[model samples]
Target chain A: MRIVEAGKLALESIWANRLRSFLTLLGVIIGIAAIVATAAVIHGLNRYVAEKLSNLGKGVFVVQRFGIITNRQEFLDAARRNKRLLPADARAIAERVPGAEIVGWEVHATADLERGEHVIRDTDIGGVTPAILEIEPYEVAEGRLLLQHEEDHAAAVAFLGHEVAQRLFPNVDPIGKELRIGGARLTVVGTAAQKGSFLGFSQDNYVKIPFSLHQKLYGTLGSVNISVKAREPARLEETIDEVRAVVRARHHLRPGAPDDFGILTAEGINDLWRNLTQTIFRVALFVVGISLVVGGIVIMNIMLVAVVERTREIGVRKAVGASQRDIVQQFLVEAVLLSCLGGAIGIAIAYAAATLLAANTPLPAEFPPWAPPVAFAVCTAIGVFFGIHPARRAAHLDPIEALRSE
Target chain B: MHAAPAPDEVIRTRGLVRSFAMGSATVHALRGVDLVIRRGEYVAIMGPSGSGKSTLMNLIGCLDTPTAGEYWLEGQPIASLGEAELARIRNREIGFVFQTFNLLPRASALRNVELPLVYAQMPPAERRRRATEALQKVGLGDRLDHRPNELSGGQRQRVSIARALVTNPALLLADEPTGNLDSKTSHEIMLLFEALHREGHTIVVVTHERDIAEHAERVVTIRDGAIASDERQPRPVRP
Candidate 1:
């Protein structure tokens, strides 16, 4: 018999038992849905991280005491072995490394800002030299950035983030206004541009102060992170090597000894992010694999039952001259149709869910274009893998005996 | 056993033997039966229960292979043919009318009649046309869309006959074709069979009823796994 006829026959029978067919399809639906949803979320996150990291500026790298530590033990080891990065290290790199265009250091702490009757709690505060603005360009939306004379004189000036500016000085202009930071009074020199939140955390809730006054207010015991920009984008690696040598020489390390500081570039950060997402993808795939296997087994069990239930039908078909191959093809087509239907439904559900998530929540989700075709292919393979045995059983049945059955 | 069947012969069997195992002991269902059926002949093979008439019918219908014999249908030897080949031969050479009127219950009479042509790999339009013509020949032209359950017993049998004739095979093999019908319906089905035989189709009807066998031109009786009588008589006309 032709495949089309077989398909029609299979469809008729499946339609005759709608509830049972739906139950049989549930496992495949869930498996495909989970995998597709995971792929969409992971794909979206990957793109988001790439975009965020690109904002770190080209040819710029960071040197810090502890960078990208993953586990508790690694953190402990780094804390014990690494020396604190000081402002003098940044000066040394700026003076000694010809390839280093700008070397800057900054330190961070959490403090409350009070302006008149209003207070913003637990706001991030960063202290940096005037040159840090050249390395990490913070956009000035109002007033002007702090001048070189401000840092040289240890000036009591502050740069407020967009959120802090909006909340602390809502009724009046923020520039030249006085705000108290941890018992010290400072004038707001500028307000930074509005940078949106990342993963639901506000990025624009911070204040910047000159390095010298930050030392007087918060003390110099805390380690600072150094940022360096290469004079030329193409010479970034050479500039990093030169700075590493200068810093290591100042610390008096042996020629073959490892540097205690961590240097991170945008590429390194991207690689780390990729590794994390890949691990997540692998775990999701494992879970999806189990679901698919269970789904396939359910399909196989139901197909076996269908074979037994249709034994007399098989006999009638054979008596009318249906070949063994025809019978096998009929049943196999039915199984594939069932699974492919499940896959299609699953993909639709996953797409809707991803769209909903992207629209309503901070979690990133992008439904990949390749998911549907690949999902259908997987479903077809699963159907064939699980459907062959039952189809063959139906084909090999003795027609006389089958017809004899009630 | 090695002889080739004549061109006019629809079926020829030589020393056909079939045996089955009942527990540890083997029971011979057909023991060295020889038979020949010609084109356009109407014959009945009748016997009491367990006398092996059904087994002989199964063998003749190509539903079972003989254990130790040679059989030919339409000049082709088929006793040793494989399952696939047997299926093809059955599709192309023989039509079956069952006592139960084995029409697929969900299908209309037209679809059921189209089944044999479907396996024959005929295209859809031609299959539909031929199936319709066969149904009209069986006097069911207006009942083309009726399902088996909606039809009376004789009408269901007529649908089966339409399905059987749609293939236009070399032989029509019926296993107790009127067993489930009342006397009046059985007479109608037997009359249709007579008309089909007159239209030059070879037919073999297997039954234990002497009244049903009397309608045929020839009757073969089975007693103990072998033919007991092969006799020809005048065709009976219904009053």
Candidate 2:
């Protein structure tokens, strides 16, 4: 019965002082909504990229030096930690590896050039053999791809990166245009299709020429990496072992020596992304969790003030036989109800804000399966933790003194 | 329990003293007082402010323990009990009415009346029934749904009386119950107190008005925390 009265009074107080209640809830609302919206966007972007990256094949793997991460230094460090491999290693793996299909040789260099009156300068030029196209996502926009005959001839033909074509030939076709790089004249047979951005730069902003051209122009000492495709992606490990055997024999390495290369898979990239984002989420959780602490403090202070304001009420209840424990429990329950109510409001606000953002803005958001319950649990904890001191003070008050108080 | 004490001394206190420290001075609110109240008796404690009338009412109602005294309440030594035990005695025994008509502002009459029963841990159904009957007894049968703010001064006082009578406790403690009401309403409330006394409910009322004191068969006066007078007119009291 005391609990009932306490609950009634608590609800009435919250209703009467609505502005203050709303203000107190503001902290929670902003914190939860921000986190939800931010999380949703991150999750959406990851899904979008994952779909694009993994669409072509179910389990295709890429083995490279330093892995597929963006930081060039980390790649170099990892490369140095392992031994080096020449293009002959790829040739050996292509001939001896059984489970994987169509291994490729790739080399990359950068340069400036001119042809006739057209000049394309300071470009990202990639050198690759014809087999590289089989393992990579590439399509010709005009003419045709550099064939085996062209590779053997070391033909002076170039594929214009989308950005380079747009810059050099904005209103005209790029095919049949000639450009020069490393003082060598080359004809543009195709142009890369539009690819907006990858890791913050246009993916189409690159040129792919034959590997032999890169060896001659960039010099023999230029760094390079070998890429392999599995004949059966599901049997990737078997092919990896076969490649290692072939490479060890070709390079004449001892059994115990570490190979100079790295094997990177799509799932490894996924793991790296998840680990990296999870740390960011952890930090976001801490920041938002502090808002809950502030919310708890607001609740505690209000409850204490409520206890003081209702001193006469407490006295009357006592005169009628309310026990100390009864009073304590009543107030504690009221505090719980108050904070839980605020928490519920916070969750609703988060959802509404998330929906609003998802509808009108590029910011991506989705409600987590556990977020609402976690929010409620946080509110409950805040209530209980902050309620104790005020409840105890009310319960332990002197009945006689309290009754006589105004 | 002294074999129930002849029904004339439902309450007895000896050497009761209550003092408060106000800055540098010690204010004695009840100074070594001795008193006895009979069952089914109507007693009025009257005095000016700071004359210990309220103090005696507090001690008599078992709201407070005397600094030094022996208090026998329903054959129990309330003065020697701890706060929890004292609370039990207060819950099952005393009904307090204040000058301010201290009804909870947000509670309806029925809820206010059910408060004591709640402390007694009475089942909700029985509590509801008893509270309804108590309100009907106070002539508030139609006002049970009214909160304190919704009721008039007189009606509010009646609701408080109903709250006091709900548990059928050993005694009703009324401290200036009509202090906030007009003269006619005060007279009517006093008549109700007299009727309750006649109906075998022990009552102790505190007032500063001599006319209010006349409604009780016994009148006790206190001055400076000490008993100044005690008188009872036996068999000749006007109903």
Candidate 3:
């Protein structure tokens, strides 16, 4: 018989028992739903994180005592003899690396600042050099940034961030006012242009002071962090390598001793975030994939019961001259049809639910182009794999016994 | 001993023994039975219960393989044919009507009759056409859409007979075809069988009822798993 005729017969048999057929398809529907929904949500999260990391300055690289990129280091000791790259080393790289522009180091700490009645406590205090406004991406809004003369005398002047300036001198100008920091008082020189938010924290809240005044006030408590800018995008990797080698040579460390400092670039951070989410996504897919196996088992069980229930029908078909293979194929077709139909429903539900979540929730989802078709194909294959035994049993039935069976 | 017959001999059996394994012991259904039947002959196999008459009917219908036998059906040894080939033979050459009116309960009369032809792999148009003709011949053309549950017992039997005749097989095997019918309906079936026999179609019927067997000219009596008598009344001329 033609394959189409065989399929028609299979459908006829399935229609004969509608309730049983739907119950069998139910198992497959749930299986595909779980996998598709979870993967879409995780995929969205991965995208959102990469977007945040790339929003920082163009080709910016941070060298700190602890990794700001992929790996987490417990210790922060760039002071090791061969690890610490001083301001002298920074200047040498600024002149040596061809496409390198300005390079500067900054030390970070929490500080309490007071002006008359307004006080800001536990605010970020950055100890930056005179070249920070150029090398760092901090733009100037009002007054000029600290000049080279100010750094040589270890100037007591400070640059207020936008939030701090508005808080301290509501109606008055902050560029010429003096504010108490940690203990000593310093004059405000300039305000940084808006940097917006990074990772969830406001970047507009930190205060920048000349490195000499920061050291004069909090020398024993804080460590140093460095930032560099590349004149051209192509020279970034070469610049980073040059910094690494120069820092190591200044510290005079032996080979193979682990470097105490860490370097972070935008691309490096993006990769780290994807790696974390992908692992979680795979684990979720596998956990949900178990449902597919359950669906297949359910089909096998139902087919076997159908074989027993329709023993007489089997006999009637055989008595008329159906081959063993014909009987088997008919039943197998019924099973595959059920699974394919069920799988389509599953993918639809998954997609609809994912779309709903993406629209309403912060974590959005995106389905892969191949997911629906591949899911349907797998469901059909599973049906055939599980439906064969029952079909064979029906085909091989003896006509006499089957005719007699109730 | 058996003598090989020509292809025209519709059914020939010699020393055909069929035994069933009943628990630990065996029950012999047919013991060294020898018989031969020809085309266009209306033969009624009559016997008492436990006389292996049903066993012989099943063997002749190719529904069961024998324990040991030399049963040749239309020059083809049925014992040597595999399961599928036997099924093919049954479809092409044998049509059966059981006493219970064995029709698919859910299907309409037309669809029930079309079943055998469907298995024969006939195209849809031909199978449907032939099924229509067969049901019309049995006088159930108006009841084609009605299921077995909706039809009367006698009408149901007529539909079963229509199913048996649809394929135009070599022999119509009716096992107690009228056993479940009232006398009036039985008489109607007998008239239909008579007409079919006159139309040059062969028929074999198995029944214990003497009155049912009297409708055929040839009657074979089986006893103790073998043929006890073979007798035939003189041929009556058609009107």
Candidate 4:
């Protein structure tokens, strides 16, 4: 039989038994919906993580004593063995790596700052050189950034972040104001503009001061973190290798020995994010796999019942000269049409659910454009897999016996 | 077994044997039967219950394969044909009208008539046109959109006849065509059959009723899985 005719017949039968058709579609609907919604959530989170990682700076890399620790045992082991990064290590990298643009180092502590009647507790107080601004590139909203001569003299000068400026000197110019930091008074020279937040932690809550003064006040409390900016993004790998060689040489490390310190870059964070999303996607696929099996089984069961119920119709069709292939094609089309209908509905529901999640919750969701077409293809595959046996049964019916059934 | 049938012969069977397994016992339904039917002849096969007339009809209609026989349809050896080829023969060479007026309950009369053409893979417009013409020929042009249940018994039977005739088959095979209808409706259906036969259509009606069989130009009676009598009538009874 022609495909158009088979489609028409299939539609007529489905319309004739609407309730049974709907029941058969339920499993497929839920299966596809779960897949689409999970994909959207995962895609959204991947985009969110990418955006956050990008803010860590383009081609910017950080070299630390212990690195961004991901495991407890490894972190403790690294802390026990690795030497703390010193100001000399930063200077060595700046001199050796020709591809490096600006090499900056920083050490921070939680110190209370008091200005007139306002006292902000546990404010981020950091020691940095003038080059830190070029590495991190924080926009100065007021006054000017610190001068290199200030760090040379260990001058009592500071730069306030946007949050600290608002907290300690609200409604007044923060620049040129004296703020007491850890019993040392420093004049604020500039206010860094807002840098927003990362995963709910405010990035604009720190204060910057000269490295020499930090050493005099804190007295070697925490290890320093070195920030390096490559001349160009393409030169990042070459600059990192040069820096690694210089730092290792400065520490008198032997050849073929592992570096005591750790190197981190935005690419590492991207790799970690990729691994996390891959795990999530796998779990989602497993769930969808189970649902598809259940859905396929349901469809097979219902199609078997349909074949039995329509035995006489099958007989009539055979009597009218319908070949086995014709009968098979007809039933297959019905099953595929049923599955595709469910898939379309599921995709629509998933889109709506994703939209709702992105709008109403902190969870980010991105509905991929390719999702609907891929879902439809999977639905067709499921139908073909489950529909064949029943269709063959209908096709191979003995016309005389089938007609005699009822 | 006899030799192959002539080209002009629409159906021929020789030494046809069909057996059934009822548990351990093999019952012979058609034991060593020979039959022949020519084109443009209205014939009826009559028998009592368990006389194997239905089995013979099934073999003749290509609905069943004989266990042991040489059967031919239009000079082609049907016993050697595959299921798909047999279906093609049924579609192109035979039209079946059931006693139950087995029109699809949900489809309108017009759609029911279009069934065979649909399997033939004709385009939609052509199938519709042919089905409409067949229905009009069966005097059911005015009831094109009416479903089976909405039509009277005679009308339903007429719709079945329309469905059968739409394919313009070489033979019109009816299985006790009036068995489910009342006497008046049965007479009307028989009259329609007579009209079709007068138009030079080769028709076969299987029945146990003598009155029904008397309308055919020839009658063959079966008993104990064999032909008991075969006779020709000069003047068949009018409906």
The DockQ leader among the candidates is 4
Instruction: Give the candidates in order of lDDT, highest first.
Output: 1, 4, 3, 2
Docking category of candidate 1 = medium
- Find the 10 residues in a row with the least total lDDT in model 4 chain A: A195-204
Q: After superposing candidate 1 on the true structure, give the runs of residues whose Cα lies further than 4 Å from its correct spot.
A: A95-99, A134-137, A231-239
Rank all candidate structures by their TM-score, best first, as comma-separated numbers: 1, 4, 2, 3
Regions more than 4 Å wrong, model 3: A12-16, A24-26, A46-64, A68-95, A99-247, A250-253, A263-274, B234-239
lDDT of each: 0.91, 0.78, 0.81, 0.89
lDDT for residue A284 in candidate 2, whole number 0-100: 89
Q: By TM-score, how accurate is candidate 1? A: 0.94
Q: Identify the runs in model 4 with alpha carbons over 4 angstroms from their true place.
A: A111-125, A142-144, A153-189, A197-202
How large is the i-RMS for each model, in angstroms? 0.8, 1.8, 1.8, 0.8
The DockQ scores of all candidates, in the order shown, are 0.78, 0.55, 0.46, 0.85
The local distance difference test score of model 1 is 0.91
lDDT leader:
1
Model 4: per-residue Cα lDDT over A68-162, one tens digit each: 67799988888888998998889888888888888898998889999987998998888998888777787899998888999999999999899
> What TM-scores result for chain A when each predicted structure is judged separately against the true chain A?
0.94, 0.79, 0.72, 0.88
Candidate 2 regions exceeding 4 Å error are A1-5, A42-58, A68-87, A94-260, A356-363, B1-15, B21-27, B33-38, B117-129, B223-229, B234-239
My TM-score estimates for the predictions, one after another, are 0.94, 0.78, 0.77, 0.93
If both were scored by lDDT, which would come out higher, candidate 2 or candidate 3?
3
Cα displacement (Å) at residue B91, model 2: 3.2
